[model samples]
Target: MTVTRFAPSPTGYLHVGNLRSALFNWLIARKAGGTFILRLDDTDPERSKEEYVDGIREDLEWLGLTWDREERQSARLDRYADAADQLREMGRFYEAWETPTELDLKRKKLLNMGRPPVYDRAALALSDDEKAALRRNRGTGVWRFKLDQERIEWTDGILGDVSIDAASVSDPVLIRQDGQVLYTLASVVDDTDMGVTDVVRGADHVTNTATQVQMIRALGGHVPDFAHHSLLTGPTGEALSKRLGTLALRDLRARGIEPMAILSLMARIGSADPVELRGSHDELIEGFDISRFGSAPTKFDVEDLVPITASVVHGLDALDVDEALSRAGVPDRLRKPYWSVVRGNTATRAEAGAWWPVFSGHATPEIAEEDREFVVKAFEMLGDPPYADDAWSDWTNAVKAETGRKGRGLFMPLRLAVTGQARGPEMADVMPLLQKKPSFD
Candidate 1:
């Protein structure tokens, strides 16, 4: 069966860039009706944390990408050791006795000579007797894969056929002298062992593919097809990183960002004309298109999120939104207050009353006070009766006469008070809920 995997190192929170790679891999697996695997590359014991590993799984689940199998590199050390031994027996790998300082000097010399500073064949000339002597002396040396000095080529699904000069590439260290497997070897071994057919990840790993392909070939394992998707970029055209202030999935979730909103944002991140996707996760999965991926990097703009946020707020079922607010620790009475404040500022309301007082402490004093007076007088004129056609007309005229404010000024503040935002649906659609005797305090 065709298989794909998202193997992220559990070193930090899941950022947008990592989420995009996972999303793309998920799309490929689903589109092909194949298995999707989730692997944690937790080989670095110091950096990888159980919390981060659990978080990655949660993030993937939130994005609605389910994996068929899960694996951890830390749990499969013996497998990698076996692969290292196999390569050693095939004469495709060797132990290098060069100290760190000596290797650095060699690399510096090569760079000075205008040549790529790689661990060339000079390290491979150690005799069996010399190897034994070094081992006997308790000398610590890394196991390096001896790359074949011929051209290595592969056809990338997205980038097309690409070739690299094997001579220019270094003999990569498979196992560090400390006996820890490096990323390249651990990744390839796991990919092959898991029967992964395609390798889909971010372009940041593009250069590493060459080295991984070489390792796979050395071990007589089938190298999977690759598709290097572009990275998610910030507005400044730089790749998205934590340093750039890209929010983490956990942070976004804490800020009340819906899982669908996050996924919708991720789905449209790299599109030429980014558009939000609505509906259930399954519906999104059915309609996902890899071809829609833009060649240029996607910018993580907060402005790009406004439309989706509005849609989420507007389409939210009243009961669901109320429940969500309640679960979010918003008081039952305060739910409508918050909703009203959000809706009033964005929508056109008949009049605003108690809603105005809620925004009195807000930074926009003039707007808040104006909306408060409107609601008070509108309710006063309505006289506690259920608002009807006549009541609506009376309330409108009363507000115009009493407040002497009209159009945007009369309506905007009320909307702002209810929604706590200045822009959203009109007040006419927003007032009915407040008229039903919702309490803010």
Candidate 2:
């Protein structure tokens, strides 16, 4: 059976970048009829908060990304400690004492000589007496995983064949001097222990995956299949890292982007398939193929979600928007009628409120300066609202005859005069819903 996990740190709200990983892993697991784990990498108790954990769960629930079980790294600290001891016994983990200043100077010197700034393993040469003295002066030393100097290669699910020279990369720090286990160590331990079969994450983690492959082998564990999907960029191909605050899942939800619209776009934005709005998660799951995705940075624009959202809103059942319609002061009798009349015009369910005021005669008309007189004349010929079902046709016919206007010239101005907008549901459908007469006075 296949197993996958999405490990997110509850330090902040889940953003779009985080969503991609969660979605990919979820699809892979569900598609295989396997288990999906929601692992919280809350090793850093200082930054991680309970509120953020609740927020993460809420966001995933909103997106319909349900997980089978949840795991917290904080609860598995002993497992990480055991793995650290195992690596130490095998001579694969060593203590390193170097301040930030000393490491920066070493890196600068290496770059000046046209060499990679890999760690020189100076700690390996220190004898017991010297190591004791350094530890006494520097406090607790950070634990680093000593990588074997060789080429590490794997066939990535998305990026195809990959290779990295272990000698050129610095040995990863797995445990801090403050006695906190970092993600690098905790993730490997959890993945191995939980029987995870696949790992999917962002393209930025390709190097991390290369190192982790070695770590998994060092611990006598089976390496899962790894894939690195492309990162998202702004509309014009700019980095989205700086503007992530506005791209958070909560922000997008507040902006009225439907869950299906977001999921539909995200599931295929970087893939070979064209993005098509899916009405249900089942449809999205049925169509998902991880192999179809490319490695290039995918361009994402918030504006692209508008049309999709409009389509989603257009197809929404009355029950789906019941609360929103009720809040808009739409009475029980007019809820279905009002939704039907304005559903096409609305890009979001919240936008249905704008039409209630228009229908109830509370909206001010938006006639242009040149068209104001024409609108006043039309209102005179049409009289007050409380219109009949055919009132729009009867009134438009009267105005068209008096002004020698037909087609857009006559209909466009009247729509603006009555609805306060140039476009809306057919005036015929809107006429009977009007509870009060529209007046330009």
Candidate 3:
């Protein structure tokens, strides 16, 4: 059986960049009839919050991306400690003491000498007495996983045949001096112990994956299949890292972006497949193929969601929008046809609240100065109350016949006088639903 995990730190609300990794893992697991785990990387208890964890769950639920089980790094401290001890016993873990400024100077010196700016294992050169003295002065030092100094390679599920020289890369810091386990260590331990078979994440983590692959092998764990999807950028291809804070899933939902609209576009934005609005989770699952995706940075436009959301709106049945229509003050009797009439004109059901006034509220016509005379004449011809499907045509025809006005001159003013707008659903369907009869003075 296949297994996958979407491990996120509960330090902030989920943004679109985060969802790309999450949805990929979820869809892969679902398509394989596998188990998908939602792991919380809350090792940094100081920054993690219960509210953020709740928000993550709420966001996933809203997207219909359900997880089978959840695991928290905080709860698995003993397991990580055991793994750390085992690595130490295997001589693959060592203590390192270096301040931030010391590391920066070392990096600059290495670059000046035209060498890879990797850790020089200075800690490994320290004598036993010197190490004891330094530990006493600086307290505990951070733990670094010693690398094999060879080429680490893997056939990536998406990028294909990735290779990294371990000699050129710094030994990863696994545990801080404060005893907090970082993502690299905790993820390797959890993924190994939890039986996660596949790992999918952003391209930025490809180097991390290369390092974690070595860590997994050292601990006698199966190295899962890895795929690094490209990162998202702005519509104009600007780096989205700075703008992701504003694209939180909650914000999009508040703006009335349909879940399907988001899911549909996200699933295909950088893939070879063209994005098509899927009506349900199953349809999304059926068409999800990670192999069809490329490694290029995907350009995402929030504006793209509007028409897709409108497409979703146009497909909804009456029951799907009944409560919305009712809330819009459409009498229960008329909601059926009311939605049918206005559905195409809306991008989301939330817009129905604004449209309700056109039928139920006073007709405040913004008649252009030039058309005021024709509009007043047209309103005079409109009969009082209880309109029908033929009311607009009948009224416009009568006005056209009496005033010698035709085409735009005759039709434009009547529509503005009656509905207060020039563009919307068919006037024929909008006429009978109007309860506030048009008034002329």
* TM value for model 1: 0.81
* Two-way TM-score contest, 2 vs 3, winner: 3
Better of 1 and 2 by TM-score: 2
Query: Which is the better candidate, 1 or 3, if ranked by lDDT?
Result: 3
> For candidate 3, lDDT tens digit of each residue in 134-191?
8999989999999999999999989999999999899999999999999999999998
lDDT of each: 0.70, 0.92, 0.90
Q: What is the C-alpha RMSD of each candidate to the true structure, in Å?
A: 5.2, 1.4, 1.1
lDDT winner: 2
Worst 10 residues of 1 by lDDT: 345-354
lDDT-best of 1 and 2:
2
> Between candidates 2 and 3, which one is better according to lDDT?
2
Off by over 4 Å in 3: none
Off by over 4 Å in 1: 128-138, 242-246, 271-273, 291-297, 325-382, 398-425, 435-441
Ranking by TM-score: 3, 2, 1
